[model samples]
Target: MKLKLVLVEPEGMINFGFILRLSKNFEVDELAVVRPKFQVDHEEVLRFAAQGKDYIEKVKVYESYEEALEGTKVCTSAKVSGTDTVRDFVLPWELKEYVGEPEVLSLVFGRESVGLTREELSKCDLLLHIPASKNYPVLNLSHAVAITLYEVWKQYRLERGNLPQKPSEKDLEVFMRVAGELAERFVGDEVKRERILIGVKRLISKASKSELRSLLYLLSRCSSFLKG
Candidate 1:
């Protein structure tokens, strides 16, 4: 999984510097800033970033969030509170369940004072919140980034340790096709068939390559029997 850290409209140079250091610590593939209030090469930024100054220099600056997320396959926005319309909240620890090994995954942090706006949060594919005290629910910009990155790094390490070989995109595509065909054969109703196919896709998405291979073999045998 390629991890990209994005800070939207960041105002504090010191915080930006700390975030750059955090990005380096977590081995983030790229660091992006959208419409930053301070200059990328500000003296304080370089001073705080210290050894991570190199990362700050290479930070990608964008005019808009859309441009910042150009190549990102999965995007998650950090928010203090959930919106009524966008209520699919995934805690920082549970991020692995929502996120697979995508080629590029973008984790977006909003401004300092107020987190992501409703409109900005709406653009993100998932919403992630850290569990904190209700009295002081909000966290400092760099601190929030640090926590989120740590959880992501933990998940990456777990995946590397347990599952050496994960399923590729092609493997997932083939499984989805076969699963859809099987669902169609079993269900005559169009709506029911679509729902079943979608459920099957989600199930296969969480499987490892070896597990998916076993499932495909079983499905093939069952398909033959049904045809016979």
Candidate 2:
């Protein structure tokens, strides 16, 4: 299992720096930032990033949530309450069942204040919430990243039971491109396109590599059949 830490519209530079270190601490391979307000090369952020700056520099900046998650399964972390889709918050241990298959995982963390919006949450196949005290159930961004990444790595080790090379970025891109094409074909209504895309993205994110490949093959066959 490969994991990337995505921070969406983070406000503070210090938090960014700390999270960068946390990514290194947890051995996260990729880091992506979506529409950040602060400068990536800011002194405060750089100072803290320090040795982790190498990873920080490699951080991909995305204009939108969808673009950032183009080639990976994105799991968004959100608050656990209200009329939200978040019914039962899955513990870190339960995360094992969600992962295990060979796939790239993008663990998305939203803003420091408000977590992922309902619209953003819709894109995520699964919602991961740190089980906090009911009294006060909010966590800092860096802390959340640390906890989530740690749990994911732990579960990955247990399930994989063997070390293997992760899928290349090019492979992930090809898969996502195929998925996008399939969505465009099957889901044509402009009014409902957004909704269908979200659902489809969620479904694909959870699929194993083999399953995704199978879906791509099926999609290709369907396209060929139409052309024929």
Candidate 3:
């Protein structure tokens, strides 16, 4: 499947450098970052990414995570083992069923200090965790990038299966709008309500358009039911 990789508030420039290399390694089409801690001109990242300088420049920068995930199916990477918020959260290999063939995808990596926040993880349709030794669960940011991308690319080469159907951009927008309306309706207070809306947007980012169409229809029926 066609995919892009995103890094959120990356603290290590060196990791960014190697991740850029990994992007090309996996044939990933885009790289998006959200408010990186270090400047792009910083030597640590730039020097290590000398070979991938051109690719690095092509990396899109966003003021926030939302901006980076706009119009993309965002997937979050986790360090924990067992399933949680998103069921069936598995290693990249198990995700083969979802990948092979072609679809727009975005894999997100969070900073080292505090992995992805609960708020950020809520936005993803799928959560992926690299299987690591229980003794030491944490993985270096760049290493995690290399391992996950490799598994994804390996799966792509082996299966090469087609998807049931791909969703259109228009379908996704309508679904988002419908979801937004539902969230605003459910959460009455304005401040807390906005947070709920953000969660909904994140949850749907990874859904296929066909999946979303079904969801939109369900949401419509729910709206009518509420009225009665």
Candidate 4:
């Protein structure tokens, strides 16, 4: 399981530096920053990062959240609060259940002030929140990153023992495209087609690499029959 840490528009150099260190400590495969507010190589950032400057030096910068997660199979946005209607929010410890083995698992931490926007959250596959006091649920940027990374690390150690390499984002995309085509061909109603596609995506989202391969095979066989 490869873990990627993404920070969106972080303003404080100290926080950025600390997160750099945390990423290294947690053995993150990649560190990405989206439209950072301060220079990444600022003295303060270096000072806080200490020995983790190597990770900071290789930090990938992106203009948008979507670009940052280009090849990520599973992405979770850190949020302190969300709409009551959105029931998919999961606690940090429960994240492993929502995310099966994937080539790249992205953990997105929002800016220090406003956090992730609803639009950004919608793009993420899941929402993760650290349990805290209601009076002050939001946590510092680096702290949140540390906690989330730690949980994921623990989960990785527990669940990834002897597991096969997971499917990549490209693999999932191919499956979705094939499923969409099948839905369009067999399901006459637009609404029904959309629903079937959504259901397929949800199932694929939780599927492991072998499970996805089996599903793709089944879909391919069915698609061939439909064409014939």
Candidate 5:
């Protein structure tokens, strides 16, 4: 699985440099920063980056979070644990299962102090939370990125380019598009409508190829019926 590490509105120069290093170490396809607070070329950023300092010039800076994550399935990180739609999330270890069919994955992370907001977290296609003790679950920004990348590497590297057959990307995109239309057609509440779309997208990500065929066919037929 190809990974892109995305940090939103980050403020720490140290975390910035460490993340650059992590991106290099983990082979992340891209390192994207949204509205960063520090100068990317600052001396402190270079100092902390160590061997990773070469990547300083390679960072992709964005003006907004939406612009940063344009064309990838967004798997967001959070620190909380709950059943609420906004906070409900998959564990980092289980992320390999969600990488299905899609080649590029954007792993979006929030700021150092407060993490992703409820609205931002809720809009994610797949939410991931690294489990920790009840007393203090929040991890430092770089550490959290480290753990998540390590887990992704641990699982995906074992595949050795021998992943199981799944629906083609074109087919998956059509399935998601139709499913989204159906959700918009039937679900009245805009927020609930989005949750339905997110839930369906997550299910599609986790489904086996055979299972996806059936689910896709069902959703397509439903959409056709509504269109008629």
Candidate 6:
């Protein structure tokens, strides 16, 4: 399970330095930043990084947030996902289950004062929110990173056994399209069609290889019958 930490427009010098140390401590494969607020080698950042200052040199800088998440399963963390009505979110500990066996896991953290924007959160594959007391659930930038990274490290670094392989993106898309077409042909209820589409997507992400192949074959036969 490869890991990458993505900081989106990080501003606080101390928080950035602390997160740098946490990246090293957790053995992150890459530390990417999107348009950082200060110079990567700023004195204040270096001073707080302490032994982890060397990791600064390893940071990959990017102009846009999407560029940093290419070829990886993108997970964005926030105190509260304001757009939850339209978007689904997961807890930090459940991340391993949510992803579809991605080659790299890219964990994105937003700015210090405000978390990820509604648009950013919508684009992510997974919206992660740490469980906290309702009384005051807010957490600091570095603290959120630490908690999320720790949970991820515990899940991936200490694996118990072999894991199932997820279907490729191409196959999943084809399967989903076919399923949607089938729904359109037989199901007239718009609400029911929407429900079926959502379930089909979840199935594609978690089904085993043989299972997915079987489903594709079945769907193909159904489509053929409809044509006949």
Question: What value does the lDDT take at residue 127 in candidate 1?
Answer: 80
Per-structure clash totals for the candidates: 0, 0, 1, 0, 0, 0
Best lDDT among the predictions, by candidate number: 6
* Residue pairs with backbone atoms closer than 3 Å in model 5 (clashes): none
lDDT (CA) for every model shown?
0.79, 0.74, 0.74, 0.80, 0.79, 0.82
* Model 3 C-alpha lDDT per residue in residues 50-88, reported as the tens digit of each score: 677667766888897887884334454555545455433
Candidate 3 Cα RMSD (Å): 19.9
Tens-digit lDDT string for candidate 6 (1-228)? 678898999999899899888888888889999999998888998888889989987799999888988545555554554665434678877877878567888888888778778788766777778878888777888998899889987787855444565678888888888888999999999999999899879867888766888999999999999899
Candidate 3 overall lDDT versus native: 0.74
Residue 204 Cα positional deviation in candidate 3, in Å, after optimal superposition:
49
Q: How good is model 6 by TM-score? A: 0.65
Q: What is the alpha-carbon lDDT for the whole of candidate 2?
A: 0.74
Please identify which of the two predictions, 1 or 4, would achieve the higher TM-score against the true structure: 1
lDDT of 1 by residue, 127-191 (tens): 88777787777789889888888998888754565545678999888778777778888789999
Writing each residue's lDDT as its tens digit, candidate 5 over 1-228 gives 567788989999998889889888887888888889988879999899999999876788999787777445455554555757666678888776865646778888998877788777766788888877768877889998999888877876645345555777776788888887877777889999898888878778877677788888888887778778
Tell me how candidate 6 scores on lDDT.
0.82
lDDT of 4 by residue, 1-228 (tens): 678888888999999999889888888988889999988888899899999977876798888778888444333444434555332578878777877767788888787888877777777777777778768777888998888888888888545645676778999999999998988887899998898888888888888888899999999999989889
Q: Which stretches of candidate 6 lie over 4 Å from their true place?
A: 77-87, 159-228
| Model 3 / residue 202 / CA error / Å | 50
Residue 110's lDDT in candidate 2:
91
Backbone clash pairs in model 5 (N, Cα, C under 3 Å; residues 3+ apart or in different chains), count:
0
